[model samples]
Target: MKAAILLIGTELLNGAMIDTNSIYIAEQLNKYGIEIEYKIMVRDVIEEMEKAFAFAKKNVDLIITTGGLGPTDDDITKAAIAKFLKKKLVVDEKEKKELVKKYKDRKIEKKSNFKEIEKPEGAISFKNDVGMAPAVYINGIVAFPGFPNELKNMFPKFLKFYAKENNLKSKIYIKDIITCGIGESILEKRVKDIFTEDNIFYEFLVKDYGTLIRLQTKIENKKKVEKIVEKLYNKIADFIIGEDEERVETNIFKYLMAQKKPLTISTAESCTGGMIASKLVDVSGISASFKEGIVCYSNEAKIKRLKVKKETLLAHGAVSEEVAKEMVEGLKTDVAIATTGIAGPGGGTIEKPVGLVYIAVRVGESVEIIRKEFKGERNKIRQRTTLFALYSLLKMLSKRYDI
Candidate 1:
């Protein structure tokens, strides 16, 4: 089955709000062997909505819409669909009761919710479990509420309903290989052999944590798919960190978890401003390994907090590997990671340009410091710096523990 997504919102067109609904819908549809042929974003105008609808009917068999399903006057999704399908809009009695019960449960006595319960003629309206507004399945079009949480909650139910209604043959399968300690461009070149094979497809997404190689196939044989993944893994064995949904900190945390006793770790961040610590803390039960994180941005903080020598900062400047080395010395933990950088559009000279960063990793009795200069905006520079810090920590943990 082919699908098209129509995301309607003036806020999205104006850049005030981002439309994440299309991505969710496309991924969900793909799982059920539904190919998304087109994704369109239209402002809250009936003419534009009808145009999007007409285009979808010509190219796809199913249509999914998200957004503009609100109580406000600008919510014209139902009105536009009604006009396009030549169907009358009427109040869904069952949906009206759900809306009333929902309001009464919250002590709201207003009957204004009846307007929000309107549905297309002969449409199957699904009640929203998490928010106001309802999702509707009618005439080859499925409409979901614009709010992300509401749409997410209703998506699974819609999928079950779609499965019962239509018989599907193909099933989408996906495998992701997440790798770090290598550049995306270099990784792309490394995987040229995989892409060179006929009748196979791949996608490479470069992220701050790592580059993710997503492999998708509709072939019925599971062993054939496994063989493709194994070939890719063999090609990039040294660079691969983990599989789908795995992260740099996750891989490191798994290694630590395998040890007999938990090892405590600390961070001393400069331009990254505790981003490394934030990522590690995102993992649950990390308190067993992650001890503390501190952002010592100023020279005084580095000196007073992390015990960086004043003489070192004066000699090598704050953005040097020497200061990063001194910053990790004060941390009293099994391991310490420190970063100092110039992530900036300003504060740069000929000797020290923007994006110049130094990451220091200390494990047991050994310490390694790396100096790198990235090319990007301030935020990108900081993000890449944190990635290198985690990558370096992973490399050190592997060597020290032989995991």
Candidate 2:
């Protein structure tokens, strides 16, 4: 089935609010193999809303709208749809009673506030448990409240109702191979030959964590999908971090936690701030393996907190591999990761330009230091350093444990 989304709000057009509802709606519809052909954003003008309705009705099988459902005068979604369908607007008495009971203790003027319960004549109404507005389904269009929380709560019920009415079933099957320390172009070039099958499809998304290689097929047989996944795995086994929904930090956390003797880890960060530590901490129950993280941004802090030699900083500078090695080694954990880089629009010399990073991973008696040059703005450079450090540590541990 094909559908279109109409996001309505003057706030959205004027940059006062962001329309996250469309993204959520699209993801949910994609699971049912519903193709989204258009995403239209309109201001809170009735004329514009009517035009959008006409376009959606003429082009798509289904239409979904979010926003302009409120008690205020500008809330004209129901009015516009009713006018477009040549139907009369009437207040739902059952919904009005519920609203009156809900706000009984508060002093609210029913003459104006009860407009929240209005719907087009002969349209099916849906309750909003999270907010004051009532949603409606009339003539192939489903109207929802603009608030994200309310829309999220009401969407599932609408989906269930629509699925029963249309006899829709989940159609999209998906698998994701999350990998790190690899560029999208290089990974795609290596695996381009594996996508020859007509029944299977592939997509590559490069996120801050890494590049995610998505393998999908409409074919429902699990065994057939597994065969394709296994073949692709063998081709890029060394670069793969984990399977679907597994990030590099999560992979590292799980690997460390499953060890017979859990290895404790710590972090000493400079240019990346505490992003590496933050990612590890996001994984629940990681404290068993993650000890602590120290942000030694200043030269004095490095010398005092992580016990780096003052002479080393004076000779080789703080952004050198020597300091990164000392930073990791001084942590006194079974494993440690350290990063020092120049992520900036300024403060770079001919010797060390911006995006120059040194990462160190120390495990037991051995320490590995790497020098890397990345390109981007400040935050992007820092993000690259953080992901590279985590992936490097994971690769090292995987080899050590033969995972």
Candidate 3:
């Protein structure tokens, strides 16, 4: 099944507010095997909204609209939708009584906002658990408020209802792996064959650290879909590190925390700065697994704080594998991850060019260092380096514990 989303707000068109509803709606629909083909944002104008409704009805099987359902003057979505469908505006007696009961303590003048309960004729209203504006369900258009909290509560129930009514079929299984020293384009080419199947869908999202590829297969026959996922899993087993809902940092933290291991991690960063530390702290329960993180950006700081030798800095400069190894060893943690390189718009020589990063992981008695060169903007390089550090740590922990 196919759907189109219509977002109504002048604020969204002027870039005053982000249209995040579309993403939430699309993801929800995808879970039910509904594909969202087009999304359009329009101002609170009657003609434009009616035109959008007409266009959606002709093209897609389902139309979901958000915003413009309040009691204010600009809240004209209900009127427009009713006009487009050639229906009369009728007040719902039960909804009006409920609205009045909610504001019985207040004066009648203050209860004016409750006028929103007067929905169009023949429309079924879905109660909003979080807000006052009730969502309206027509034949195809499902209209809800623009507020995120309200939409989140109402949209799931709406989707569940639609799925049961339409008998849509959807199945999702995700396989994820952490890989270092590889780019997305290269990874896509290597795993291209797995993406080519009659009932399979593929998406690759690149984060600061690396690329995450999700393989989704939908088949009426559940057994066939499971078999295809198994076959694809075997083909990409080597590059795959983690699976559905398990992130690289989460997996590493779980492994360390389960072992009751006391670990202190630190960073000797030149390019990545404190991004690595920020990411590590983002995971909940990280305090149990992580001890400390140090950001040594300057040469003096690296020499004084991380105990990197001055001679090494003078000889190999800052972006070298040797320096990265020394930074990891200098930290007082059971496991230390270090990154040193040039994330550049400037600061590049013939010998040391831009996008050159060296990462080191130290655990117990063994230390490993790997060098990579990434091509992107400054933030991109920093993000890639951080991801690489996490990948390296996961790899080391897996090897040591035989996980």
Candidate 4:
């Protein structure tokens, strides 16, 4: 059965609060074979909430909403749902008893938020173990509190109840083939004919390091999906980096950490401003292999820290292949990566233009530098360079022969 997720919060629409409830609920529902076809976010406004309910009811078999259940004046989710369903808002006596006992047990003062703990009439309600608000599953919509902690605590009980009622055991069939050192257009042209069948849903996405082929099939047969993945792998064995290619930075760090022999890596940054190093640090236990990261933004830093000579800088400028290579040469590690570029909106000249990036990869004794005139603004260029540097490092560690 299909489902729809509705997140009701004015703060979410105004960007003051991030709505993670939808993501969490969607993932949980997928475990029960409930596919979510629509994800919507509506403000705390009653009109918008009613409209969201109407749309979701028309679109899917199940509707789930988070937020608007808190003890505040803006907490109007039950009221909205009641209006939408033409029902009356009634106090839940059981939930009220629990709340009253909790207040007495804890010796806490009764507040305005406590009065808001009511459910819509004619609905199945689940007790909230961690909070005052009750989880109500009514008319295909499950409503939870706005707070993340309370929602997480209450969602599991709702999941079990819903699964028992629906009798669902879903199997997800998905694979992402990540290819490095290949352009998206070329990769698409090479493998376009492989997915001509009507049953497969495939997408070609361009990532910084390479292209990603996300293939999803509707059929849940494991053997059938495995055969398809195996066929596709055989066709693109030269480029496919497995599903971990989707999570490039983490995968790179994880692979490096799992090596039989420990390896050290160093970074020399220019236009990327230590973005590659920062990304590597984001992964847990990166210190196991990550040795050092240097942000040599200035020419003097390159000369002093990375031992880049002043002569090379004057001859080829900071954003050049020579400088990138020299920067790597100065670093001693199992793998050394370097970046030099002009990530800017105004640094273009007749000879050198903005978005000109030079990335260097040094694997053991071998070193290679790639130069590309990338497109986009400052932030985009830096981000692309950072991802490319990580991609290059992944190649050096995993596909040593390719480098």
Candidate 5:
């Protein structure tokens, strides 16, 4: 089924608040075979809400609205929806009693307090356990609250009810193949033949580390999609890291932990700061293999903490390949990564411009140092350098230890 999302709030329209409801709703609807055709954002104006409703109803079978459900005068979603459906607004007595008793006990009773319990005539109201305002369903419109926590808690009930009334078979099947150490254009060229197939579609989401290839096909073409995925694996299996929600860091953590005698890993970071270590710690239970993380941002810290030679720093500077190699080799661990770079809007010379990074990865006796000149702001350069450092270590580990 096709759907439309009408987001109502002045805060969202004026960029005072981000509309995260649409993202969550769209993802959930896609899982249930609903195609979201239009996403309309309107302020707290009744005329605008009605117009959005008219536009959505003409094109979609289902319309979901979020926001402007409260006790204040500006909370007009319930009224606007009632007007659009040409229905009378009525107070829900049970909800009104709940609100009245709670407010009366707190000595804060007002006429506006009952507004939270109002709904369109004959519309089905779903109680919100987390908030005061309740959600309503009428004429194929499901009105939910603006509060993210309340909406997230209440959406599952609506989904369960909707599933009972509609056929919820998924329309599309999606597969994600995440690849590291390979750019999108190169990866696309390697598997360009798969694009000629009529039953499937491919999309590439480029990331700082690598690319995420999203492959989709109609539900009926499931078997054919598997064959195509196998074909892609055969073509670019070496570059592929993990699939779906897995990232390079997670893959590395898993590989490190799965070894017979799990290898301990450490990091000595310069331009990337502690980002490489921070990402490693994000994975749960990674402490089993993750040993230490040191930030050697200054030349003295590099020399004192990681034993990077002062002579090497004076000869080739702190951001050079020589210092990066020494930093990685000095780490007391089975596997180590070191990053040094001139990630900057400043601190760059003619020879070593901004985004000039040297990453060193050492696994046992083997050490590899690579120099890359990336293009971006300081944070972007640091982010890319962190990913590259991790990817370098992952590559070496996979090749030497076959993890």
Candidate 6:
């Protein structure tokens, strides 16, 4: 079913607060095979909210609105929804009693203010476990508070109720493969048949260092869908590095731990700086695997720290595949990853220009080096280099363990 999300708040328009509720809601809806067609951010003004509700009612099968539900006057979601439905707001007795009991120690005047929380006519109320405002459902429009905690509690309950009422079945199975050293066009050609299949949907997302292809299959019969997914997975298994929610680093960690292998890794980063080391250390329990990192940006540091040959740096200009290989090999660890390149708006030469990165990974006694040229801003180049280093290491590990 098509869904439209309406995020109501002046704070969002002013950029004072981010609307994370939309992302969470969209992810939850996707689990049930519901697609959100449009997302609108509107101020809390009555006219704007009313106009948004009218627009959603005509175009979308279900309209989910978050924000502006509270005791304050600025909270106008309920009022606008009531006006749009032409229904009078009446206090929900159960909600009023619960609010009073929750704050029984407070004065009666404080509790009296909460009596204003009322639902529009014929609307079912969804209880909010994390906040005071209750979510109201009228027709296809489901309204919840703008507060993330309250929306988190209410939106899931609303989805559960809606799924039961409509007999909705969630049958989405997603498989993702991480591939490096390939462009999106080339990957698309390789997996064109999978996308053109009648029951499956394909999405390709390009990252800094590599590309991720996600294949989704939606079918009512679970057994048939599982078989299709298995066949597709086998067909593309050679190109696949990771699947579903498994990241390269995560998969590498799991693989290492499973093998009961103890490892120490260090880095000699030039263009990528400490980005590769930072990503590896971000995962918990990395101390068991990571040893140290060296950011050898200059020739002196490379020679002093990573012990790169001075002649190699002068000849290769510090950004060649040969130097990248030396940086990885000099680390003297179980595995070492290194990057050398020019990621910038400036620093371009006829031979060694910007966005030219060389990544090398050393596993056991074997060292593999790859030379790539990326096109983007400085930050994008750095990010891509870091991810590529991780992917190369993961690929080497996979070959060693036969995984």
By lDDT, the best candidate is 2
Q: Between prediction 4 and prediction 5, which has the larger lDDT?
A: 5
Clashing pairs in model 4?
none
Candidate 6: where is the Cα deviation over 4 Å?
8-28, 35-37, 43-167, 171-173, 193-197, 203-210, 221-238
The candidate 1 region of ten consecutive residues with least summed lDDT is: 192-201
| lDDT by residue (tens digit), candidate 6, 153-201 | 8887999999999889775765556766556897677657654457666
lDDT of 2 by residue, 51-129 (tens): 9999889999999999988889899998888998999988878888888866764555545467778888998988888
Q: What is the lDDT of candidate 3?
A: 0.78
CA lDDT of every candidate: 0.84, 0.88, 0.78, 0.80, 0.87, 0.80
List clashing residue pairs in candidate 6. Answer: 67-146, 208-384, 209-384
- What are the TM-scores, per candidate, against the unseen true structure? 0.77, 0.75, 0.70, 0.71, 0.73, 0.69
Q: Give the per-residue lDDT digits (tens) of candidate 1, residues 132-184.
A: 78888788988887998899899888888888888764377777788877787
The candidate with the higher lDDT, 2 or 4, is: 2
Q: What digit string (tens of lDDT, one per residue) describes model 4 on residues 60-132?
A: 9998888888777888998898899888888866677788887878888855355456777888877777777
Q: State model 6's lDDT.
A: 0.80
| Clashing residue pairs for model 1 | none
lDDT of model 3, residue 357 = 90
Candidate 1: Cα lDDT at 358: 93
* Candidate with better TM-score, 1 vs 3: 1
Cα error, candidate 1, residue 312 (Å): 1.8
**Overall local distance difference test of candidate 4:** 0.80
Tell me the spans in candidate 4 whose CA falls farther than 4 Å from its real position.
11-38, 45-51, 54-59, 66-165, 196-198, 207-210, 244-246, 401-403
| Ranking, lDDT, top scorer first | 2, 5, 1, 6, 4, 3
TM-score: which is higher, 4 or 6? 4
Which candidate number maximizes TM-score? 1
Please give the TM-score that candidate 2 achieves against the real structure.
Answer: 0.75
- Model 2 ranges with Cα > 4 A deviation: 8-11, 15-28, 44-58, 65-165, 260-263, 287-291, 401-403
